[model samples]
Target: MAGTIDPDAGISAAGEPITEAEALQRLRQSEDQSQQYYAAWWLGRNRSRHPEALPLLLATLRQRRPRDPGAGVEENAIARNAARALGKLGDAGAIPELLAALDDEDDGLREAAARSLGELQATEAVAVLLRRLASGPAGAGAPRLDSPRLQEPCEAMLEALGAIGIAEPGVITLIEPFTAHDRPLIRSAACRALLQLSGEARWAEPLMQLLDHPQLQVRRAALMDLGAVGWRPALEPICHTLAENSLKLIALRGLVEQGAHHDATIQAGAVLSAMDSLL
Candidate 1:
């Protein structure tokens, strides 16, 4: 019975096709290194088709052992792949694991976890991410200059929170604090998140206040988010500001994208035309 098994073939034992349930069982019970790796691969590849497989993969990754510290080579490989799978699956169940991995010492693992959380649109991760932002260089738990790389993961987490579209109560609360962050980049990212979550009327006031932020980029992002929020009346003053400010082209583009017409559009068009003439 000398035969080659297709690497892409479905889970099977002795060439007998296995049901998802059977594959899951094997994934949960298997201790053999080779079998675990194969199970991880199968689960990662078929995560969407078989959502149940996600928990099994996650469980396998979470369980730690002395010999297999953090599941060793097999576990790390599976966990990384499973993170990608969970992203495609967009399963909320993977949120806790993904969030936990956000601080993983390994950059690749942290990125995978952050990305998966984004794909899942897990609103719960918003609080943790906001905390990371507020804690600046001197603040407790802040990323140090020695490990500047951590900032990327932190930023990725913020971007993920924005993409998740989670309207957590804390999201609004974090807005004011972030507006004052020492770092302009963090301030800009926070403004972006606030805009992303401001589907409700509550975001209107905060967004308007952001128009006055000292940083030009923050001001621009605030204007863009306001436009995206489609608060027609709010665009009035912003339109006036854009007409006077040379660096507001991006904000103007956002307003256009949001179909912000009426008096605001008329005014913005005049400003844009004038700017074009000057160019």
Candidate 2:
């Protein structure tokens, strides 16, 4: 019953065949009051099975204006819904349009576009989103700390990139520059991206270097990422640094948690005994 098409709702009416033209026309003519709302709802609800509807949904996304009391026109729910539907479709074709929408002046629309891009796993959108994160208020450090306008989309993009996996050459190259970015957030993002791109122990060195970063958060994140790589040797330097800094608790914890001991002297004695008990 979940997958059944609802005829009364103007969707797959009569269980009859629908052409692309008909679908597009339905989307276009539904511009008035009631019809527009229904169309938006339908598009958002049925985005996946109806790939043909993508173009229409994209077109509507571009023209629909958000509801503002001052603007007079009823808020275009259909357009908003269509945008969401296109995102749910997860079709790669929608990436370009979604990227264009990233620059939308309307915060809500830009956010929806960003969400759609993430849903689609639009790798091409990665570079654009990263650039935005690196340059937007969050990356650039604006005074408005509480603004969701900057943080929401940037965070979404970061999660999306992480989900998409960083195996692509382009993705790796795009993320590389951010490693040296002035902002720790950007550098951390790059580190995470690298972890996703290549799980190789080679990344351990660079990530380990960040343990000495001025930002404590950066150090912690690097430590976590290093553990993720699970390279036994990589944990040695980290443990030494932690111990030398009087961060013995954290160093001991890292060793215990990872079942890794870098120092031969320490590994041969009670340290191993302590580690075995913890395990």
Q: What is the TM-score of each candidate against the true structure?
A: 0.46, 0.47
Q: Residue 2 CA error for candidate 2 (Å)?
A: 22
lDDT of 2 at 133: 62
Q: What stretches of model 2 exceed 4 Å from their correct place? A: 1-26, 31-34, 65-69, 72-78, 136-148, 167-279
Give candidate 2's whole-model lDDT.
Answer: 0.55
| Pairs with backbone N, CA or C atoms under 3 Å apart (clashes), candidate 1 | none
Count of residue pairs whose backbone atoms collide, per candidate: 0, 0
lDDT of 2 by residue, 144-174 (tens): 3645334334434543565466477766665
lDDT of 1 by residue, 189-242 (tens): 555566566644443565676677776655665655555444454545575553
Best model per TM-score: 2
Poorest lDDT segment (10 consecutive residues) of candidate 1: 1-10
State the displacement of the C-alpha of residue 60, model 1, in Å, after optimal TM-score superposition.
4.9
What's every prediction's RMSD, in angstroms?
12.4, 13.1
**Residue pairs whose backbone atoms clash in candidate 2:** none
lDDT of each: 0.56, 0.55
